[model samples]
Target: MNRYTFSTQSGKAYYCNSIPGFIADQSTDIVGRLVRHAFDINKEQANAWENQITELQRRLEECGMEGDIIFEYDIVRLGKRIDVILLIRHMVFSLEFKNGKDIFTTQDAQQAEDYAIDIKNFHKESEDLYVCPILIATDAARYPNPQSCDCYPDKQVHLQRENIETLIPKITKISSLYGDDGEIDFDKWFNSPYYPTPTIIAAAVEAYSSHSLSQIAQSEAGQENINLCEAKIYEIIEYAKIQKKKCICFITGVPGAGKTLVGLDVVAKSLDDANGLSVYLSGNGPLVEVLREALKKSVESNDREREDLWKRAKKSAGKTFDVPKPEKLFNKHTQAAINTLIQSSYAFKKDNASHSNPTPENILIFDEAQRVWNQEKMARKHDDPIMAVSEPKLLFSIMDRHQDWAVMICLVGLGQDIYDGEVGINEWFRCGIEEFKEWELFYSPLIFSQVEDKNIDQEKILSCERCHQIDELHLKTSIRSFRADKQCQFIDALLDNDPKQASEVYQQIASKYPIYITRDYSLAKKWVRAHVRGSQRSGVLACSSAQRLKPEGIYVPTEIDVKNWFLAPSDDLRSSNMLEVVASEFKVQGLEIDWAIVCWDADLRRSKNGADWDHYSFRGTKWNKRNKPEQKRYLVNSYRVLLTRARQGMVLFVPKGVDPEEDPTRDTEYYDGIYKYLVSCGIQEL
Candidate 1:
């Protein structure tokens, strides 16, 4: 009668009727209990389970297979349940049942594969075993041609199809291919350590509502820094409240060290303040859109799912409480809810009034603060009064309008300014000295003299009596590459053209995280398909200025519907899993994917001497290089963003350019040098 139920049996002992007993007990009470506890359980699911159980029982009884059988295995943290997991010898068979279905859909295969992958990646006992995900569509016409298992990497899953009639032969083939080594200990497998990775969508919703971060973020190395950052920010907020003075903190981190997580935590913790409230603001349009839609879906759908359960629990218990209305809290009209908790800086500027404070949120958290525009870009883009001033100066002025104390936290990232107008960290220094001298400034000690690339006035910032530097303000770990901490180091060495160091670091981490390169996009796609298993995400990525990639059949998604592009089913053409429509670096900056194909074009390439940044505008029929410093930097940084987007591994596809006699624009000379450089940097060429 418990929710999220599962049955397990030891290997070598066989089933002994444990699984059969559970399936055959089809009383009204038991069925009702299962229907209530399990999600999306209907006649279709019941029929599928009944058929799958009967077939599995028959196969086991006839074959006399050893090992264990687990029914309805629960991947509790990921919110997934497998139909049946067969632990035989050292292999884990992840089965998904489709009843009365004639064909095995791609989505169905992906769903089965995801369950297998989740166990292989996160289940300790199954990590060393061969995980095979099989989809059994009971009424399918024909069985898939069984392929040898030599092509797959260790623990890498492959999708196999079967029908109810072919189940015995399929099992025999798999068991023979992967010969039985030893009996599987089902008790140990059931209790194996499961490290759950909450998607960014789930993390955002949980953090914004409950301020509980540790449960969602399973990164052991980065959790300390997250906690430290949060504690320091809270300390600053308390000080600002007591002293009745304005304070600003600049929190910096390497690419994916949970800066956004800290920012959302602040927004959640500050929501209920009767007087001085706070809102999370960002300049990243795609991030905002994705987060809003994800939060909306979480609230609306989850609330309805739990409503009936809440009523039933209340009836059994002696106490009654009002059900939480997530829709009301996160609706569009509610300014303080999730939709308005984050807003675009440009939109905030457009809505700014000359003399009034906007919406009474005294505390402001700005994500990606380094990407804020300087005065010139703002003036050219906007006609408002604040357009002539830098964004930081304008924001400081707006916050200073409050008569009481206020706090502003700038969630900054180092070396992520991939746009022309971004002034990096210097804009904040200028604003602090010339515009808002009275407000206190706080930063990490590593920011001052360490920033060599930017022209920051260190003297002006250091001269302020209220300047304070705190070490806890900076996050030192990269949470995105939780398996390989040296991922960012390897990227830096590669981008800096230090091939020796890059190769050394790659050798250290290559076994854990694989990076491949190819001259053909087809090879890259094929490699991605082979390596990716389970519910792992894969996509094609390109630079925003990759106009030449159109000839290679790679088109950048111009108008990205962030939700569908990130969360759609694999079979959908719009989904990133399709590998047809590629997303640009601009749309995928703060996100991570499991596997990716980075299509390298001539926008940014390597010359014989060093890295080359050619900013080209495709006007008429030719590529004209824009001779501007900012434009060149943007082009270079765009590649940097694309290069580091993949969390697990990536394949760089440097095109083999057309002959000079055919298309002069895409000459062979333009691409060969870059491809060679990438190869030299220890990227395995496929």
Candidate 2:
């Protein structure tokens, strides 16, 4: 007769006196209910698995198994009843079911062995025939000894628990003597919902998730490929990971506030987890290329080899495959591209709903979100009634579809740079966009002045009415440009002064930073050309609307060469998904210029409004006074764009006596010109 024995660290032999540690973990239900995931399991799954063993026994007998079955029936002599007991050839065959993974351990394996021996001995004196013990576990993924050590080699079998209906096959197989005929038909068992079906466990690895199961992966030389979360980026990572109450965090920053840095850091934090991904997007095409090149360093550095080395990688899995491993190829750009394509590709049929399957790698970030919000106004479809990308409604629709996925969409922009109409038409993104919004102001934080009471509010004067609804956070700190406390004060004071004082301080600031005022278009063009070359630092050529700065030579377009930008208000411009095609006129703003020339000629100066229209124009298209006012408004916007763009120095030109040293206005139009506009906009004249 077969015999079984069970003992612990104490080494005392265990009898059928009491159940072992196995029974302690079981409450009223199996232990798997305790397992949790990043996402929640539906409630319908709960009641379906609730257990009562009698139902299983009845199910087996109904399926034509000629035997009496008992449910949770404890044998008095045996101490504990088996989950399933059958009578065959007058010998008892006991079956124990392990549905929970917790029961699968080395100790549990030993316990199962002991039970088999105990049951065999229990029926050792059976007057009839052979006796055996059957051990069956359902969906026990963690079952130890899939080969050699335990009797079963496959931890997960193709049979999941369902209505008591599944008991028939389970009983028929376990009850029969062990042999080839006893083998399970996995194809048939897989379709049976009466028990847990076979499935590979979701894997956890120390490496990055770049490869797919369809592809094989080779290990890399160094662990550096995966980025470690550190510093300020860690907070953003925590915010994305653990906020139970959902919040759409819209982080607004100026040109260099490190929005991309923070965004990337968030991406780094999520790299190891299955619930996170990183994506970096921007409106600037050249900048995007630069950024892309920069990121390749990290990816390649982590890989520790050149391109040829990666191609030669052999699968460590020992199986040949065609596809790349997700761990090997899953870089920041790859994730970004996947998510962007997923959102951009959809047919919005009326009344239709969509579902998204999100993995940790699903993330969509808009670096130049302001640009994305607008339909391409200049590139509108000829048949479509609405203006192209600049149209707010269409952009809202795009963002809405993505919102349905509960995607963490991050939008970054500066108040001056964004067209407000194109944002937040969807409910999910509505909160905190305007009033609760952050960072409306962009300036040197400690920059205070005694000469001028306050800095000019661009909207109050320049009439930049777009994005009025957006809640803005002003970044008070200046990291890009540095100025001493005294110089900063001096610069602010000089800007508000009369032309003489303004010129004096402008010269002073220029002396330190070097702003050369040149009326010569050739000089300006030459200086700008030199700056455009990618160097250790950059340079810009700023041209105001009053001055028409023309390149010294005839312009020619070539894919291979640097193209010079000519500042002209009428320069045709277009917006594209792959490009930011603005003319030299508008492009010069918000960018650092090396040298700027104020080009004052007929075409640019003609639109210079009768200073009277300046007040009404600053109030938005509130007037029906005609395009005359509009032209003047556009002209002011042109100037604002020009003055703000230059980093080192800029030149100014005014019609004859319209003071290059002070406010430019005819004596009679003086109040209507610079005075009224300045006072309305809160600019204190020094």
Using Cα atoms with residue i matched to residue i, what is each candidate's TM-score against the true structure? Answer: 0.78, 0.36
lDDT of 2 by residue, 1-686 (tens): 21122222121111111112223224223314222311232232232224433344245435544433322323322233445444432334455555433333333343344344333322223212233444555444333332221122111111222223333464355444332223222222112111000001101111123322111111011011111112223333354345421123344443323344334434433455465454444444433333333334335544653333334333222355354533545477765643332222112211122233232233444444434343343244223333343322332333334322222334443333312223322222232233223211111221121001123233332232212222222222222222211222223332233344444444445433344433344454465444321111122322222221222222212121112232111122321110122223334332333334433322222214532322222122122222553344344434444444433344432222234345322222332243333233232322
Off by over 4 Å in 2: 1-240, 250-275, 283-290, 293-364, 368-473, 482-508, 524-534, 537-686
Candidate 1 lDDT tens digits, 470-563:
9999988877775566788888788777888998999988887788888988889998887766567789999877888888898886777767
Summing lDDT over every window of 10 consecutive residues in candidate 1, give the lowest-scoring window. Answer: 9-18
Backbone collisions counted per model: 5, 47
Q: Give lDDT per model, in order.
A: 0.73, 0.32
